[model samples]
Target: MDSSLVMIGLTNVLSFNNIACILGGTLLGLFVGAMPGLSATMALALLLPLTFSFDPATGLSMLASLYVGASYGGSIAAILLRTPGTPSAAATVLDGFPLSQQGRAGEALGVSLFASFFGGLMSGIALLTAAPLLGTLVLEFGPVELFAIAVLGITIIGSLAQGSVISGLLSGGLGLLLSTVGMDLTTGTPRMTFDQINLFGGIDFTVALIGLFSVPQALTLIENSHQGGKVASRITDRLMPRWSTIKQLMPNILRSSGIGIVVGLIPGTGGDTASWFAYNEAKRFAKDKSRFGKGEVAGVAAPEAANNAVVGGALIPTIALGIPGSSSTAILLGALMVQGILPGPNLLTDYGDVTYTLIWAVILANIALLVVGLAFTKMSVSVTKIPDGFIACAILTLCIIGAFAINNSLFDVGLMLGFGLFGYWMSKAGVSPAPMVIGLILGPVMETSFQQSMLIGNDSFGVFLESPIATVLLILALLSILQATPFFRWLRVPFKRRLKPD
Candidate 1:
């Protein structure tokens, strides 16, 4: 890396425009993420078209900050309303809402925000140190290894459906089906277009993301608008996490962050899965598991740290191997490609200075998130006070604009509305959209790699088993599925009983 170029890049990011974008993006993400039905995926999709016109560095810097902030922001409502703003926050509501009920809402929110910042910072540092090493390692992968990585990604979908891993697998299968709608990349043959011109390109992932995340949220908001009350009583003081609290949470935070960084290094696991896994593990490891769902501060701390840490974690492969760890970063990767920047080994060799600058940008962006997030924390809470009528109109407008903006195609606008109604129905049925989003993000990667691996092996029936990496991944996937079943819990009872007595 050229020291001068790296210095220049830092100078550029520190400029007023880039700094402002970082703050602005954080604020926007916080607001969207705090809303009960809005999600990080939806916010990213809505903002994607707008970033097209920005400097690649500026655009990504903003999105990166938003990604970090939004993940944290969801914990706010999870604490206050018993409604998680993002699926990653679902575990937060286990204990966060109870804290609010006890008139400790401010304390909970403060701890959440502070923990979020810590996790994000730690992850950023990890990204800076780890991305290059992992990226280079990934370069050794062939189709078999890549296919194994994709299957591991699908395992994350199971975590979202904790009690019924089969349902999660079904959701993933559906996503693979959807990915096949477009023309085949390898053969140029259309398999599932249904003879429609629009279907030739397949459903836009952004459109699906927007609808899957946002529309259901809008319906929930409409239903909940009438049942209103101040969800908090006296706000607690000492918004910052005290040293004692930090000490108590340190072990869990470290554990969860390790989970996040490792999961994030995988090609498709991303932050959402990291958050879920961290939340579950934190619960399992707690000395008093009973305290977990009843307002344990550690519950908020663990996932918050894990998810944000994923930001830096995901960036490792993105910077090193040129593959994205999450959907949001995948979109950013597309933006990089549009700007004619190749991401991968050559990037570090040829433009290590620029890469360092990008790492610096990540650090700067997170600092901005912490500062702006703390400053405007109270204001973000007030957004729920807006009338449902206004939210309906605003969301509808954004839906229209977001859809049309993607490809300047009115057909996409219709697609958004159609999926919007579909999402509404799905929500009413109690099917969380988080699984769907996970499935969608992992689907294409899994399919392409699966097909490619099969081809490389000359379509031999036993090729997957022949590959050690593939066999290990298959075992992990099976284990993940088994862990999600009731049989596993049933099997654990005798082991616990044996440990307890004669």
Candidate 2:
């Protein structure tokens, strides 16, 4: 807020070299994020050493732009291939690929691009103006509240299921079970590693993500080609969505941005949580719920906005409190450390010029994402039309390479193949993998918070009930579960009327 520092910051980032850094890093991030298994964290890590040559402010600006660009890039793969290019893109696959299948790939890409821009811009504004206010909020969330949040996040699997509620529950439970495969965080004992060193860290989420989504689709493409399924040709639909379409999706995009900010501000959760949460809320708010996962633009809009918004939201805590909100932000924090800029409450004060340059860079990068996406989204439609045979091979190679890249372990690759088979079977059984994926994501947060809360309360279950916020969240979670039942749907719950005859 200091005028002198603000002016210095503006001047630093606006320089031609820094602007070029923003553009180049954004382009690099876009390509990296569009590849399955590669992540923003990975890309930033690779780019970190190169920043040593640039001025501190300029180097920070480039990294910030890459972070913003990668947030939008993951949606590209989700739209084209039914595979999440990054973990945060998982929810995008639900609606994006469906629209692509319907030959509306260009429109889907456009919606995702604009939604990401809106969300990222909003998040950047919040970071610029409300960092201190939002940072204070971090203190209010104790372990109990976090556990409640995780519980609420888990319950949304019912909303994501979209087909059979029971099947969704089963899938979510399976995810929770799989999440326990890692070492026991509390006792320092292995729970389900099964004597395999690779299992010591549990399954890498990316490996599972690539295998479950990417491999199954690849295999399916092969099967469809063998069965003589029609291969769609390259589409040439207009990439720029009509103004009317943007107007209709604006509300969903706005709401999803808020969700992303809240979720990202929390230290442990990330964009993946925000995206899925936004997707569920969008479905909950829809007038025609059945349209979800079947080419609905709102479905694409909500997740894209939320996930991209998370980049800005996650940075608030990292900048204001020095607590990294997520892994990508943590790596960004590392970049600051490399430049001798330590993170803490005094971070902005000690290095106001450079820090503010980072903040402004995120805003500028979102604008860059819009420009690049508009020009490239239409061209990206080609990926949706690759011949089935070649597409199948490409997907398989990418998934395998991605899985192996996690730790250079053949075991991870084999695990990915195994999950691919399982995911294929789950698809046949009418079970949605989204819920299971949600379960895997929320499980650690739930387990850790619950255990920590129990320790604080001397093993009393009353600890969860003591907090008003936790109590309300638990009730909402319960409501989510109850509403998913056949009885509630049949009765229509709150709207059911008493018999007039009485």
Candidate 3:
């Protein structure tokens, strides 16, 4: 990165408006994450439409702060209710609730808070260092290479998704099909508009995100409202852990943070995977594994640290290569495109002021996480008190208003509701909507790049094969998909023999 760009970023983040947004976002995230059902992704999706009114840097910084805060806040419900507030907090419940039952709630909360801060801080530093280097390397890519990158993204995300690879790929395909809804760019004729003027420009990505994430979540919360006993535990002891305890766990925290950063670099994996991976590593490294689920502080520290670390780790590819590292980053990338900032390698140079500000915001947001988390960790239980039925109603109302607010079009609102129902159905079918959203985001880029590459290659199909980067990426995409196939074991037979000989 350039010194000038760093200076520009410093100024952008230091502004009063941006600082307020970051702090406010952090508070909101804490509240949302303390609830048992809401996720950082859903919070981000619901709040995305509101960001359009602000400067891109401020809005993005706010969202980044929210991401950092929510990652930590999820640990609260895990400790108190024995239920994870978010999927990423699932591992924390293994030890966190045990501590609460043993009257060490404060100790567990303190460990979680400190671990989250340390992990997020380290990941932010890694993001600051890694994204620019990767950006420079990718700046050489042409339309052919960009198209290849898109193909690689789609395949990798699909293959690694939580369900069957076929389902993932189908979701991605559906998103690509939906992305073609607007008028054709090359020809003035509409492609999939179905004679609706609202579809002329295209489906609003923000509208779709709000509907897909928020509505289903609200509906689920309503369905599960019959369950009770969500009383929050009170923090009676001092919130901070002893310095000796911190020293003892520093190694575990550092190792888990590293694990988080690496896991987050992958496109399909998210904090949930990183947290579980870290928790297992902690157990494996412990002298007495039997203590892991019995109110062990290391168990609490590992998962919280790893999950919060994912914030900065996931942003690297999103900022550097325009390929979202996780679902949360996918929304952030969508917000960028919605704000008229094109996604690609030049994010460091062409949009340095905004991009660099976002980087700085992640670092600062971690710091803010430490301060806000310490002060309000106990007080956040108030948020959990709100009834699920009320939350569902609020979510539905907000989704409708936000969808309409995008273009003041009732058709968009109806479309959002349609996607909401579709999202709910997908959840029942065990399909993740993230891959679909990613495909939707990447579709236009892939199409435009392919068309441009063809034009550059004199309308020859051989153009795709001309670039080495494109060729390598296309091969990787093929390998990614093939690895999920039934014949992959057969394909690995030769490698197995070679490894055995070695």
Candidate 4:
């Protein structure tokens, strides 16, 4: 809130060098996000080390731009092919593909691009206003409260699971176990390292991320190479929406952006959840609900708006609480640490200029997205025409390079390959990788905080329950767990039946 710091931040972000970084990052993000089997998180992880050479503000700005661009980019594939470029675009496929099939691909792309820009713009404004205030409030949080928050985050594993709650829990447990493979932080003792010196530091997260996200995708593409054809129908209509259509979708866009912001503020929820919630809300409020899945412009707008808004919303918790709101923000948190910057309450206090610069960069990224998305819509559609063999090889090569670049060690590459196979098997079993990634990211935070809380509480576990904040967080975690279970739905069914008075 310091006037001088704000001015300095604005000046730094607007500089030629930083603007170039933002532009380059946004273009790269669009390419990655428009490709099926690629995700923003993976792209950021792969490109994180490249930012190490830049100044803190410039580096962070680049990552922020990538995040913003990727959030909008996913809609390209969701509309063109039946495949969503990123998981966040899953809801987009419902209406996006239908519209494409009906030869309304251009209209679908226009609505998606415009809605994404509006959502991101709104969320950027929210981030500008909300993060500093949230940072001030969380400054009061103790170790026990932080530990409780971590637990609450972990509970979201059930919501992230692609299969049953049990599967999600198991995957989360596996990640936690993997996290413990390195030397014990409390003591110098090596916990799970089979005396291998390389294992002393544990598996590098970047390596694991590349393996889990990229490798399986490459394998899938290779396996499905036989069914080679154009990815989508030709887009032949106007690339921009009519003013009347835009006016009709304005309400849905606004409503969905609000939904995205709220959901993104909650730890562990991401764009995927926001998009689905927005789509459902749009359907519930529509005058003609039957038009929803069959090429409705509102349907495309609802999800695109929500997913893009999540980029800014997710950054709120990451910047303010040092708690990642989603997997993508988790990678962003890691990037901050890599650059010797710590997130949380002190972020705005110690690095106020840099923080504000990142926020401004997000706004700029959204503006760039609108221009680039509209200009490249026709050209981007041709990307899906590339052969699967070429795509698979390219991804495989990047995975190898990214994994090795993490530590300049072949051992890391081996670990990446091992995890890649494990991830592929997990996918085959219908288990979600998201819960595992969350567990890996949060495991150390939870352990260290709990340990510190125990020391503060004279080694008594009861201290966590004694704190009001911790108690509330723990209760929320419990509720999240219960809500994911079948028993809770069954219990609610009877109550709903009684209320209906049938």
For TM-score, the strongest prediction is: 3
Model 3 residue pairs with clashes: none
Candidate 1 error regions (>4 Å): 1-17, 75-110, 159-163, 229-307, 310-362, 430-455, 482-500
Quality of model 3 by C-alpha lDDT: 0.90
Alpha carbon lDDT at 120, candidate 3? 97
The local lDDT score (0 to 100) that residue 47 gets in candidate 3 is 88
Could you report the Cα RMSD, in angstroms, for every candidate shown? 4.9, 8.7, 1.8, 2.4
Per-residue lDDT of model 3, residues 1-502, tens digit only: 6889988998999899989988889988888898889999999998898998989999999999998888998999999888788999999999999899888898999999999999999999999999988988766788889898888889989888879999999988888888888977677679888788888998889888988889999999999888764687777777899999999999999999999999999889999999999999999999999998889999999999999988889899888888888888989988899789877766887899899999999999988888888889889867776778888898899899899999988988999999999999999999999888988899888888988998999999788888888888899999999999878978788778988854
Per-residue CA lDDT of model 2 for 24-58, tens digit only, reads: 88876787677555567656645665665678888
lDDT for each of the candidates?
Answer: 0.72, 0.78, 0.90, 0.84
Q: How well does candidate 3 match the true structure, expressed as C-alpha RMSD?
A: 1.8
Candidate 3: stretches off by over 4 Å: 489-502
Q: How do the residues 404-471 of candidate 4 rate in per-residue lDDT, one tens digit apiece? A: 77788999989999998988998899987877877777788788888999999999999988999899
Please give the range of 10 consecutive residues that has the lowest summed lDDT in model 1. Answer: 229-238
Query: What residue runs in model 2 are displaced by over 4 Å at the alpha carbon?
Result: 132-235, 380-502
What TM-scores do the predictions have? 0.77, 0.60, 0.97, 0.92
> Which pairs of residues collide in candidate 2?
none
User: Per model, how many backbone clashes are there?
Assistant: 2, 0, 0, 0
Q: Candidate 4: which stretches are off by over 4 Å?
A: 1-8, 98-103, 288-291, 342-346
